[model samples]
Target: MDGNTNEQPPAGEETPAGVRRRPWPLRRGAAPTGVRRSLRMAGVTLAVVLVSLAGVVLGVFAGGRVDTDIGPFQATLTLTPDTSGGTTVDIPPLGALLLDSHDGPTHLTVRLGALDQMRTEALIDDPASIQRASVSAVEDVRTGVMRLGLRTVASAVLATLLLAALVFRNVRRTALSGVLALVVSLGSLGAAAGTLRPQAIEEPRYEGLLVNAPAIVGDARRIANDYTRYAEQLQRLVGNVSQLYTTVSGLPVFEPAPDTTRVLHVSDMHLNPTGWSLIRTVVEQFDIDVVIDTGDITDWGSEPEASFVGSIGVLKRPYVYIRGNHDSGRTAAAVARQPNAIVLNNSTTTVAGLTIAGIGDPRFTPDKNTSPAGSGLTKPVAEQVIGAGEQLAATVRNSPRPVNIALVHDPASAGPLSGTCPLVLAGHTHARQVSMLPQQPGLGPTQLMVEGSTGGAGLRGLEGEKPTPLSMSVLYFDKDKLLQAYDDITVGGTGQAQVNLERHVIKDPQAGEPVPVTPTPTR
Candidate 1:
């Protein structure tokens, strides 16, 4: 009997059932090879599918939603899926953050997609977290090299393929197929990660703000809460001015320019004499031909009644005063009384080579939290609110001189009217007590800024900081219609005894050339 044949069993090779000890050479040798080939192809196919899906989900979908925020003084992030419809994301005020002290240590909030979220979070906390997360997310996508996920499935497939190649020589280079896939997938993922989330500064100008976001967010939160509380108290205080402690004299003084544009961009005055005095100096020094008081001329509906009205008279330039929410009723009557002052209740004006449009406060206070002196708490009708926005639109549209400038008190209104006019000057968010760059889009790239009294800049308002303090923006427009110069006049006298003027020039975007203005003249 031959080994290949079925014959009587030998002693050692006897079958368990005592049958023939015949080895079917052809069938026995081919079984392992066939099984291995099938397993290898299946494993390779699975790896390809997973890598492809991950590329689509992470690269295509996640790349579009990258946005950043800084300052409420405490860096905290709330990430919600931006579902089919609209999404409302509430950025917390600094006061709301659960923090220990009012200073030190920054925080970061990162949002990752469903697939990589857990892995990414682990990497963020680990020693080489950032590097690992970024590498894992993109290794196969860009480099076409083997990544963990791709490599995992690839290895399994490759093992089977290697076995198959050994079994079936006619299969033609089965072992090398996985190597190609590994390289291609790794390269693809790496490319996708680099393109989508580069480690370098996305916006070089905003880099500082982004870096400082964690710490700033914490401080800003507490400041904002204090402001809101103060505003509530001040609202009641304005009803009885005798109780107020702060005065205009305590505010910073302004230095007027020798030559006058006659335009005054006074905003977030907050009825503090310090701010008013600074505004007055700027007006007189510049010999302003016209004054545009954007809003928040008064601290709140409260404060010494005379302070808000008197501050207007103090400006040497004839002014156009718009009502800010803080002024509410207190400043309206006073504005109406000023013969030289054009009181725009969401109206237009053409004065001194400028076509100016004004909008009153745009924020909707659901309830009359507090009323002006002697006036009962009153909630306005919906139409009145809508009408105010319409009036602003109409005012801009009807401007006789091709709308050169826009004036409003609340910086919030700027969001709607930013690119509409050549220049938009507003007050509310008084530069955040310590000013930084204007963080609004289409505003400026650099974080260069103006300081507010107790409140903040428009960025603060966006951060939910209420009743930003007093400051003024002075814009100098040349004859060619280019804004030659800009100035942020600080309004208070706390740290600085006198008014401080931080000025800069507008660089032309197309030319990348700076258009210089005369240095700010000293008082």
Candidate 2:
């Protein structure tokens, strides 16, 4: 051995004793430490970015349409990009049942895709099933989804590590370890996203008996934004339905009296979609012969607002609609599209065995005034209402039906037809009231009923005032085709709830009394 400190290894000669290993393949001077660090960090950064991008692509495109069966009800749902630049699930009402199950007056919402078996419990009427489905969904996510996500994350980490090793062959041992740690953490995040798989939602179900089920569907591409919101809404509806079943389970199931005509009078929906669902419920429960709506159906009566007209079109029952102050002729045109709707404006017609005549609001929409601003005794509001009432009174002058009912929007205009009509129904004021108007000597006495806003004062009603309960009247006719018992149902007032219905005995609707309610009540 030579005694030289700076000696190079001899060609083809193996090192004899204590020669140390190098941190890299190359000589120390050929590449500086800084260069090696740069290589390792750059490779790692690139690998991390690729992994994240892949994870995002997978997350966005992973979900597709899945069939969701909630007991006897079934519907298809999927999460896709929404026009609102979010994700949402679109579900058409499975049947009339779903079409009529609304959360509130105007808002219809459901998140069928977010419910795993566990969350679906709320939709079911039974307590045990809700518990089971909820537990199962949670377990599936924890045991199945978590395990699958871990596998994906681990695979991603291993692949990125191998690729980084290939690209940075000259990195130091310390730097390699650091790079591995960084890659694993980031890769774990990318893989964890797989755990968010909403496909599991298709499994959890609302399985059990349900008193009523609404159409549970909507655009759900926005589920990523807030799945909890839609999920909770479905829960509340399910809870309410459960409450209804619980309330009536012990009582006698109602069967209408023979040869009796039931008319459900609802007014001032004011574009509250919830009312239609309630209307459907009342009609089904009462075996109603005809459904009548005193208008203000649309708030502004604009073109876009016309879309809600489709809701009324779905009612399979006989429906009679009259225009109100907030309604336009176009509103009537929309009502005409509904197969069962009776357009009884300024015309006397017999429907459901009763003659009905109506007057359209004089002003239609407040902005769509009939009176061109003129120098007259009164402003447009009074002049318009009177003219419309006169037109209606003119048509009913000869008496069309023995039990003629007059439909108008304003109660002020309802009295003129007292002598002509035995029963007068009007809606415009957002409060409930009843009055007796003794007619001129020869005619029968008239009862003027002004129904409270069916929308609980509507969406606009929610502002500036304590919220009112949704209100409407169910008028029952006797074998003689005379008014007998009327139910004034109020749901969810400012401080009241649980679908309270009060039965009023109108011993003689012709007596023009206040129409006292019977103490018997159903919640």
Candidate 3:
């Protein structure tokens, strides 16, 4: 053996028995002991270097294609490079997912090619199933970063604890171990935070995880940008194609008598002072016991503009509330300050004899609104809203007392509450302001509910043949639990003369109920 002091083995030669293995190359003029320590620190700190050398290997070998299942629908997702700049997806046998089958399973398939591009296909066996399927991918890098940081920290903590046990014996080691563990944990967390992407990547595949790639990149982008548009289109389609029952029956009705408490239901006031004043006046005149304003009290959230401040003193009774599509943090805060208001985003409250559960708005579908300002709740927010609504509804439905009434911002959202509550009051259309419906057979003489200006029509001031009053509605409950509604038109001023309007009661068709339902004490 040669008398060399160097610990490294000669190239292509078998290693000497005493030398320990090291990660760095042992070339001549290589790092000294101090330099090696600095170099090790640098190597770990440079995430790009670590990623290029190691992460790429993990991504290539450990990560495979992603698969997703939407209900009965299943899809195989793969990523391919985009011949174009970024990426686009190919929907194989295009439009197959739109098939209609009530009894069949809706399945989807996707294959990633490279980069982030993928090909998607829909299974058409059950056409109806395809329509019900809501497929999407979750590509949240923050979650992954947090998880990685936590795991690394846990490992560092354990290691520090072991080192303390060995180096400092019992007492000192225990305390020092805790300090070292905390330091290592923080260091690991910092490293993870630094490595995390600033902006979320579209087509995540482990390292670049590929889920439902098309959903992650294409459909999801549209959802994020134009949720209301998508939602509206979906609503139109569902209304046209779906045969699901819109009304649920077998619910006990509240009798329209004076003994029982009745809720004055109104929502989506949309900053309409006329509507607010009308509601308050009617409640006082008819002696309503409870008021439930489902949501959207303000047109633009925040402080009510000058136009809306007049509505502040109108409410006299405690009103249960749920936020609306237009409600913002600022609006919610303002509304919360009202002594008579109870904001129940996903909470329960009781008014009079009714256990009222409330939720805000439904998820914002891009198709829901036709405005350019991105005004309404988008799909994700709408979903959260709807989910909250559903949760509240379920809570109320499951309660000891039956839900007598439900107030929602949009009349369209009342579907879920229809049968659950004996009555559902919704007002988002602004009454269509102006509408024309063509005559159709079996639809009862074309059934027109159009409005004309008060003076222009045949009737007198605030009387017959007037415009549809921008008004509030009161639900009447009697001793027997049968319920009815009364509409109040709004005038102006502080006294009863300024706010009182004519009330129209909606008669029940199934009961063959009589027209001109007389108002009993609304309380």
By TM-score, the best candidate is: 2
**Greater-lDDT candidate between 1 and 3:** 1
How do the residues 21-40 of candidate 2 rate in per-residue lDDT, one tens digit apiece?
34335665677789989998
Best by lDDT: 2
lDDT of 1 at 187: 48
Worst 10 residues of 2 by lDDT: 100-109
- Sorted by TM-score, highest first, which candidate order results? 2, 1, 3
Report every candidate's CA lDDT.
0.43, 0.56, 0.41
User: By summed lDDT, which 10 consecutive residues of candidate 3 come out lowest?
Assistant: 452-461
Residue by residue across 1-523, what tens digits does model 3's lDDT show? 4776765454455456755555547669777799889987675445323322232222212222344432322334322211121212323322112111111111112422211111111211122222344332323222333443344444445555554455446655355455544564464334433443424334333212223234322454443333333222322322221111111011123234547566665655654323443454456555678776655565434332222423343466877776666566556666666667677765566666666566666533211231221236577655654565466557666867766555555543443443455444444543412111232333311111212111111011122222223334455555544454443333221112222223344466223132442322110
Provide TM-scores for the models: 0.39, 0.52, 0.37
Residue 473, model 2, lDDT = 86
Report the C-alpha displacement of residue 384, candidate 1, in angstroms. Answer: 9.5
RMSD over all Cα atoms, model 2: 14.0
Give the Å error, residue 40, model 3: 67
